[model samples]
Target: MKHKIALITGSTSGIGLGIAEAFAAKGYNIIFNGLEENGSEIARKVAGQHQVDFLFSGANMLQPEALREMVAQGTEKFGSIDVLINNAGIQHVAAIEDFPEEKWNAIIGINLTAAFHLTKAVWPNMKAQKFGRIINIASAHGLFASEFKSAYVAAKHGIVGFTKTAALEGAPYNITANAICPGYVKTPLVEKQIADQAKAHNLPENEVVKKVILAKQAVKDFVPVSTIAELALFLASENATTLTGAALPVDGGWSAQ
Candidate 1:
């Protein structure tokens, strides 16, 4: 059997990179999309380690045309995209009243609208193939809320709704669409948040993480990128055919509250 192909956006680092590693380990050819800097080198390393084909595209998710071209290029290179992981995201911290217009637009563009564009770009091929996996990397904020995160919260909630819609549409075609909502993962994004929170709260970074960041989380621990990657693997597996339209939380019990 021919190996499957996975196209993961923002896969040069963080949660996206983690998911790419997981899929590559399972022998899926990878098409990584992110910044051009070091993207090819990362792809080469992953391909070498897993003995699977890898490609990289520096497609700016904020540009709809670029996103479409990315999907087109990946499909042309790998025949078809069996899995699409919408993992690209950006963040801005500000109250609703203070949120800059450009910042709001950019966050919505990258975090939410980009997923819509990529899924639309891939839908036809997925429908024809009668198989696809669409996984959106959402956040616990999608379910809950936090201060100084109006744009992030709104975008994440949008992702959950989008995942549900995609799931329903793809159900008959054996495609699954799901969202993974993680809470305070130990990624660059979260590290930046820790610092910002510390500054905003006038607390030390450790205090910001423990007292402020993890305060609402029952387990009071950061979710691991590896754990999220494992969940993505399961969602992409045949076993998850019946698991579409779901928002699964890996938030150290944060959403349980």
Candidate 2:
């Protein structure tokens, strides 16, 4: 039998990379898409360790055409994209009035629109095969709101809605769509937020992380990327067939509040 394939966007590092590693360990072939060029080594390493095929696409998620091409290349190489993980995203923190128009566009385009495009691109193949898993990496902001995060929050919320729509449409075809809302993973993105929050609040970085950045989280801890990866694997498994259209929160009680 042919090995299953997973196409994960923005999978060069952080949460995306974590998911890729988890899937590879499960013996799934992987197609990694991201703007970064440094993923070649990771691709080689994962493939070597798992003895599975790995491919990388330096596709800019901002462009819909590039995203379409990425999906096409993955399908062509692997014969099918059984799992789709939409994890590409960016962040910009500013009041709505101060938020640059370009920044809003970039965030919305990469974080929300790119997922739509990839899902659209892969829907037919998945529908035909009668088996597919669409896992979106949203955030805690998808469920709630925060200051200085209009665009990120909006984009994440939009993805949640989109995931539901996809789930409904895909239910008959045995394709599932779901979003993972994590509180705060200690990714480079959050690292930048630590610095920004420290500067903005005139607090030390350590204090900003504990007192400001994670102030709302009851656990006061960053959700591990591996934990999110485990969730992704579960969602992709047959055990989660009935769990579509869910916005499962891996947040440390952040969304509960």
Candidate 3:
């Protein structure tokens, strides 16, 4: 059998980076996606480390044409994209009354609509191969709400719904779509959230970390990016054929409670 190709969006940093590494570790030729000229550089480093073919395509995920072009270029380079990780997203924090229209549009456009566009763009290739693994990097916020996160909560909830529908459609074609909901990880985004929580609640950083964020989880620990990455690897594996349409939580038991 030929080596499978995996394309991971927003792979320059954070969860996307981790997922890329995980897929690479499993011997997948990686197609790294991010809106940076240096995206190919990052992919080169991973490819060198993993000894696999590497391809990169950068595009603003919000633009439909950019997304379509990116997918086209990626498939052309890699022959087929057997795995698609829709991990690009943005967040905005504000009460509904204070939410800016631009911010709301940006959040929804990148967080929710981009997934749909990418899915549509990649569906034909996946269907033709009758083999694909899609992993959407949703959030714990998808299943639950947080204060001052109106746009993020809404977009995440939309992601869960979209993942389900896409999974159902892809099922018959031997394609699997799933979402992974993670709790606070030590990424730059979550670090920003920690600082914002401190300022908003007028608490010390440590206090904000403990009481405001990790309080909901039974483990009360920040999730590691590797954990989510490992899950993505499993989902992409042929053994996980029965795992489609599942919203797996890597939340340190936050959603369980």
What number of clashing residue pairs does each candidate have, in the order they appear?
0, 0, 0
lDDT of each: 0.91, 0.92, 0.88
- Candidate 2's displacement at residue 223, Å, is 0.6
Is candidate 1 or 3 superior in TM-score? Answer: 1
lDDT score, candidate 3, position 65:
100
TM-score on alpha carbons, each prediction: 0.98, 0.97, 0.96
Q: Pick the winner on TM-score between candidates 2 and 3.
A: 2
* Residue-pair clash count for candidate 3: 0
- Residue 181's lDDT within candidate 2 is 97
Reference-based lDDT, residue 243, model 3: 90
lDDT of prediction 1? 0.91
lDDT of 2 at 85: 97
Q: Give residue 1's lDDT in candidate 3 (0 to 100).
A: 63
List the RMSD of every prediction in angstroms.
1.0, 1.0, 1.3
Which lDDT value does model 2 have at 243? 95
Query: Model 3 over residues 1-257: C-alpha lDDT tens digits?
Result: 67798888899788898888888887898888887667778889988898888878788887999889988988888788888899988776667898899999999999999999989989998999899888899999999998889999999999999999988999999999999999989887788888877877788988988999898988978999999999888899999887999888889999888
lDDT of 2 by residue, 148-254 (tens): 89999999999999999999999999999999999988999999988877766788987888888889898978999999999999999999999999999988998
